[model samples]
Target: MSDVAAYPVTLPAFVPEHAPPFPGQPPAIARAPRSDTLRCSTCSMRAICMPQGLTPDELKRMEALICPSRTIRQGETIYRANDSFQSIYAVRVGSFKTVVMHRDGREQVTGFHLTGDSLGLDGVSSGHHSCDAVALEDSKVCIIPFHLLETMCREVKVVQQHLHRMMGSEIVRESSQMMLLGTMSAEQRVATFLLNLSDRLRLRGYSPAEFHLRMTREEIGSYLGIKLETVSRMLSKFQRDGLVDTHGKDIRILDHESLVRV
Candidate 1:
């Protein structure tokens, strides 16, 4: 499953037709070596990335599986729905949002990926990807070939356990999103969204009470199953009620408990 863009937790993302695949074989991200070394240790988010605790030798083997990190411009599609799945990517910088296009042409957002998270779980069960990964900002990702990861996991018990846990987390997150969309009111939706983002940021050692929303209001609305206008109104309401303060994308939660109550 995807993180933000990791599949529904890997495809466990909520599927609503506010929307819009095909058949394909499995695919590698192998490429020529780059002039500059892109060591996991030297990476910006190394302390929090998946390979953080690996031994030097284990890290070396993991490095062999990564292609040089490259920038993905905002709006670029990292992988389209049904494309051949060769690897799952670790976000190194910026963020991403995944969407699945329905048969009826509607697109349902599944998840959002931030730095240190992985994407591309949709390819695990099938040879092809099950959704689309789009950059929400100028971003970069560490592409890990799935087979290489599996091979490493055979020797590194920790990696395997972590992978399992990460995938399971995605499943639970997506299920919760479904319930939120189906049962929550507009205010509740917005409140839940704030808390979720806050928690993820806190996990990354950033402040949970304050952060910038990389996602737009419209995107938030789509994920929360409300209109963009409603998302805006809810924010205004939150601000007026002193539960939060918003200045464009930068938001500060003034009353986390009140939001939890919502």
Candidate 2:
């Protein structure tokens, strides 16, 4: 397994705004490479998902069975609660938030997914979604049919290994989030969130320490189990301490090491 701490994480220089096609207009569609109809041959997330793990021929086979979907607009529902699970979704661009609502009207943000993140994988066995996935911005995803993927994995050792690793990574991420919620201070939670987001972007070939905030402070506070005012105050303190520079929604890490130590 690769060492997460040793991996170089950088943020992308440009994050394109995601815009969905106007309603009543036909949805635009594109075909994948013929060499692999079930998988995406030129997918940007392939490096994190399949490439570097699968052989050329295996990728070709997987590509042939995959279906690529184009941009989904911000605030659009990728899948609603209890929706039937058809395919696994891999984010090609932008971010997504999964939420679950309680009967008493409270909502908990279950997950925040970024570029190269995959959703709907957990529902493979149950065939039903337990949470709602919404795009935080205009985003694109590649949909891999579950049965096709399972068949491919059965035939390909590399594919199986990739799925195992992906699942393991998800487990670790969830555990980390649980730990943060259970034990971290408000300041520590915000600091860890920024550091994690920076690392994720960096891994995708973007600058690790500078980017725009796609989610609002209130949303961030809710996810962190803190007050919105607390979130604002901590950000201000971070700036005062020379740990980060924030101007409106844009932020630049002045000292990542110090920020992490916070």
lDDT of 1: 0.74
lDDT (Cα, tens digit) per residue for candidate 2, span 121-190 = 6666688878777788988776676777788788988777777777777678778878888999999999
TM-score, per-candidate, Cα-based: 0.84, 0.83
Q: Which candidate leads in TM-score?
A: 1
Q: Model 1: how large is the Cα RMSD against the reference?
A: 7.1
Off by over 4 Å in 2: 1-39, 51-53
Q: Which model scores highest in lDDT?
A: 1
Stretch of 10 with least lDDT, candidate 1 = 6-15
